[model samples]
Target: MGIFDALNTSVGGLQAQSFALQNISGNIANASTVGYKGIGTSFEDLVPAAAATNRQNSAGVTAHSQATITTKGTVSRSSVSTNMAIVGDGFFNVQKPVGITDNIPVFNGVTNYTRRGDFQLNANGNLVNGAGYYLLGVTVDPKTGNPTGNVPKVLQFQNNFIPAQATTSINYAANLPTKPATVASTTATAGGLKAYGGLDPSDFSAGFNPLVIGTPAPPFTDATTSGSTVNNKQATQISGATLLSGAASTDSIITNFAAGDTITVNGTPITFVASGAVGNQLNVTDSVSTMLAKIDSITGATTASSVTNGIITLHTGTASNLTISSSNATAFAALGFASPTTQARGGGGTVGAGVVIGNDIKVFTNESISGGAVTAYDATGTPVNLQLRWAKVDSSSLGSPHVDTWNLFYQANSSATGTQTAWINAGTNFRFSASGALTSPSGSSISLPGVTVDGQSLGTQTFNFGSGGLTQYASTGGTATINNIFQNGYAAGQLQSIAVNNSGLVVGTFSNGQNLNLAAVSLSHFNGTNYLKALDGGAYAATDESGVAIAGATGTINGSALEGSNTDIADEFTKLIVTQQAYSANTKVITTANSMVQDLLNVLR
Candidate 1:
């Protein structure tokens, strides 16, 4: 009975070793397979129960397959953009077709998971791995580029026509030099006062050109008052302690202002009250600075009236005109102003009359500096080159009331002759403070309304200078330093190529030079990965032991790469030698057991 038990146990051992050999052979064969999780043989021993304690007999041994599903495999670079690899624990949600209908694969609606990521786009635009498993993903909205649904389905991308989008805003950032170099800049070799078809510098300086050779009469000086006169130089101070009231001995003017004496500026009267309340009235005992404030307030001048080196300067800015007339002629003359003096505002004209006729193109070319250029699209996908230029309209160097100001221009027509409009002004007075920061429009954006470039209308668009996007700093070269400039709209485009990004989103590049996210790759993870029932092609199906797949796996997807099979040929070969040795040892046990039985039979004979 003992020898018989030995034979039966040895037989069971042979069967278990055979099972292990099969597993080792399979692992060695599939060592080159992609994303393959190798199977290992697990042996369990069986023992027979005895009537007394410590008297048990070995019955048999059985082998069961062990899954290395949770083990990681080596990842290698792939040339195919659609190919992907998981660096950790997760599987790609996929579907297998049970049949074909009209050339299209019909799925059984059962979702499967796989680690094989050798996916390539098929003729139907669906992603399929080498094993014919279709990849699934969440659809992305073209406009928002966000996932549309929580559940994932088979993803398909087609080359459909995209509608044209008109540009609404241009993000622009640049550093404007304190002094931009233009053809007409005094520093440039071709320097001459240029603007609006050679509009004379005298026009900007109120009929006086400082750049001229000869010593010209200062425009701020009246006919009777010369610059050489007392307290009339460019640097003379007329404010502070200097009084304009006749009651004060230190009077600023030859004829001091008396009570009831009024100075009317731009149709608003500033009355010199003896001692007064603060409603637009200057006290007779107040300083000349008080009188200057009243004048500046009435004219709405951005550059206020100031006296430098006793010389008084009045500016109209670009918003309004400057006009000063006094009820008392002597008092007005004492303030160094001729009765009824007037100065037109710089860069102020008809609001929408932005165009300069062909006659003024030469003037514009010489005066304006290139602001920058960009290509924009219309509603019909037509391209329009938006060329920008900056023209210095007014300068603080001209005197008080004239701040550094600029106007933007664009090319309207290249071939306009005679009276045909060739250029258009943006109709904004870009005023800069002493520190070169924008002070007008009170915001980061300005509108270029009704912009038509070379007969192509590009509707209204906003030019945004993000907070601190535009600056005016000292430049090594007297040119505009553009940091960034681009538009948001693009022409119609067709899908050209698609690739997975590190974020696991499928991005598609279009023929029109736009890249958009098309879909999001779905990653499903299982609680008990080894409990999953292995299927063909490195895929796995959920069993009762393995919990349902959970969405949003923690593993990262590497694009343009793939995972190799986990099976190692060297390790499987070592296992193979051990299994063969174990089988031989079991066969020896049966042979020895047979010898014992044969010896007993011989003795009985």
Candidate 2:
């Protein structure tokens, strides 16, 4: 052994302590750094292979620098949504620009993983962390909301408008009153108000129900005829009369009639009953003629009625003193009477149709089942309000419940491309089950054929009324009420915001009410993370000792949060004290060794 072996040993100790102190400094310096892995130093004794044969037993000490990569940092809340932390062992795949190649961000195809998660959208709309590395992940298909492939790439968000999607399906859920609204039996036909089955004199609107306009095999005549059979174009007697807007029922006067209904003509009470009676109490099924007779039987009223082309016209002998009012709330509407309107009395005859009428006919809209209205979008992203009205074509009394039918009519602006107000038949029968549920023509979904709203031709749209979505239940006032409705269509939209989910998905939300999966964050797991090579930023490169990077998403992602440095300030300070004391002891050992060497020289002299 050399006489200065003690000095060499002490020098080695000094170097080892210095290296440990360096690690302590680094650990303490990065305590607040996000996703920072603390570095630790290990000491080892250096012994030559021939140390047992050599005189010198101990050689020196050396430092082994290693990263505490396996240690998990404290995950804390963050204001940024893109900031994310992994609870288990994993690294975020990131790409850094090594240089520009052909004006592209060249990375030399080097794959790097990082723990730093201070990610933000850069000027180019790329997610770049604080370390100037772009985050990479797998892309996804918007239509299916599924990941396209496992291949990784830098995620870029474009600010262009999200293309408009035409409405393909509509989900409608509703509860329909089993019966129509209640009506009165003894209703006095007043002026302005028209009867439920009355014909319209002025018909400016097109798109009336085909059944109403087509010729009835047997020409429909008086008020007893079904209103659904009367069309303005019909060559029959009602050919000139505009079809009434409402469902056809036995009460042609009113679909639903209740007892105790009465009519007051110039202050005369004409109540209804179930049997033969006059002035005392009228029969519930009494016709307009019976009502006029009963009124004539009274001294206060002198009533006259004419039923032509399905319209019931009524007037009093003394028009000046005649005022027909309902004793019940529904009686007036049942009689189809309103404020006295100036019915332009045509001289003695009617129009070319020869339909007898005390006064000219009126124009009216048809009755509808009212499936409710919804805003539909066109191919070009134009929006329009579509009004739907459904009217009963076949009633349960005609045949089996399953055979009962209804017609759907849609109205929008006919003049404007996106605006339609004229009703057009949907050309589909809404059939029902014996139980009163919409069962056929397929209960699963109703396919409305091609129809133009505004000027845009929207393709066939499917309506999923839900399982048993339509139901018919009897009530005093049977009214159609839509409970729920939704459509899968949207207009053009711009990027609104971005969010990260626990599944490590970077989702971008658009103003058009769409949350699209833009990319999935990539996680790489390593077997020997400590052996990974450190890079300029807070990233690590793969090494043979580290093993191949395993694509891992098993780690729980804490979004809107960051992982604090694993370095503990208190622990680092303790290590710093220990390192400082050890350094001092090494210096003292060197000084004492020097003194001993001097004494030996003195003894030799």
Candidate 3:
């Protein structure tokens, strides 16, 4: 072996220690850098060919650099929305642009991978990381929200307006009271009966009086509060001592009668006989009152005959179907009686008491019922107010027609004919089951067609109240509660901000309270991470050793945050101390080797 062999080996040691120190300095410098992978220097020793003597001096040491790319770093938090981190083995696909301006990244074809994720938006609205690398992702269709292609591109957030959406469907959920409020009280008379109470089951909205028919006659009772009382036939009457007293013993005789004379009261005949008859036709004198007693003797006639001062009324026998007619209409009129018309009780036929039929809709005021309102949008994105009122119909008592029917009325300010606080017929009625759940208006969906809003048309909007949408259980606190109300319509919205999710989804939020997916972040994985070439700013490039990068092989993508540097500062410092000492020791060895070589040179001289 040459005497200077030791010197050469020490020189190699010095160079190796210097290389390790450089790695330590780099690690320490980047301790706080985001997504930085620390470098560790590995040392290898070379030996000269073995001699037959079995001992040979060592050759110089060789140092190589390896990136701790596979090692995971502690996850720390960041405020930037575009920031992300990797939890396992993978790298973010990024493009390092050739240049940048106003925070905008200039894209270069060169693709790189990184553990760094401190990304921010640039002037061109491109997402760029702290390393000046543009974030790469798949472009997404604004209309479909799906990936446009497998080819990745630099992510850019553009300042654009979101187009308006027309209302297609509306979802509605609310609790309609099973029992509605009552209408106002009103009074009227029918069939000579005084009537007053509710128009519906709870309150009366309109008043009706049978006095409307004409002067109520005798035997016609007062119209009761609800037209539930009996109504009888009637006629105007007059009775006193002079008209009733007759020629014989207080018997009536107002006019002399002939044998052929006849008066038919309610289809029954009163035939007058000649003067020979005794006690016939109630003294046969034809007095106004005494002769009337003879007429009451007919069937189905309730005669209140006192032979004096008793108004002829309430002729009831088997039945009181009273109608007075004769061959000559003048004959009944001549008896001090107007033409007797067949009588019909109120609410029976043409009596004309207002009552709806066959679930017909009717308008009612909120003063007599509860109401609600909702804000709806139109084609032009204008808001319209729709007001609704609930009016109870039918009865509160239980049976067939158990009285749970209701009428819902609505009015909008955008109505073509103009709006009124007074409810307008909505063309439908809501009926409820006895258990208080809605039964009619199947599906509980209502449609408002041809509605106008802010002078624009808003087509038909179907409001799905769903099954069991309404109820009438008694409760003290009521809020007109709306479980949910949403429409598929919106005005144009300005882009507000962007966000990323762990699934690598890029979302854009707008001012109109809508969020949309804009793009998708892609990741790359290598079969041999250590074989990847290290690039500037904690990045890597593909090499033959790294193999083909598999796209979409990602660890968890943390958003609005950054991944911390893997380098431990204290550990780097320790390495620095060891490297510094080793370097010094290597230098000392070189000097000692030189001295020994010089000694050999002197001995040879």
Instruction: Give model 3's TM-score versus the native structure.
Output: 0.64
Off by over 4 Å in 3: 51-59, 87-89, 99-106, 141-144, 175-374, 386-455, 460-475, 501-503, 511-513
Candidate 3 Cα lDDT to native: 0.61
Give the alpha-carbon lDDT of every model: 0.78, 0.64, 0.61
Give per-residue CA lDDT, model 2, range 334-432, as digits (tens): 445553322322112212221111121112133334568888778766776766655554556443442556555565443422112345555566666
Total backbone collisions, model 3: 25
- By TM-score, the best candidate is 1
What TM-score does prediction 2 earn? 0.61
lDDT of 1: 0.78
Per-residue lDDT of model 3, residues 403-441, tens digit only: 555555455333232122123444455666667677777
CA error at residue 536 for candidate 1, angstroms: 0.8
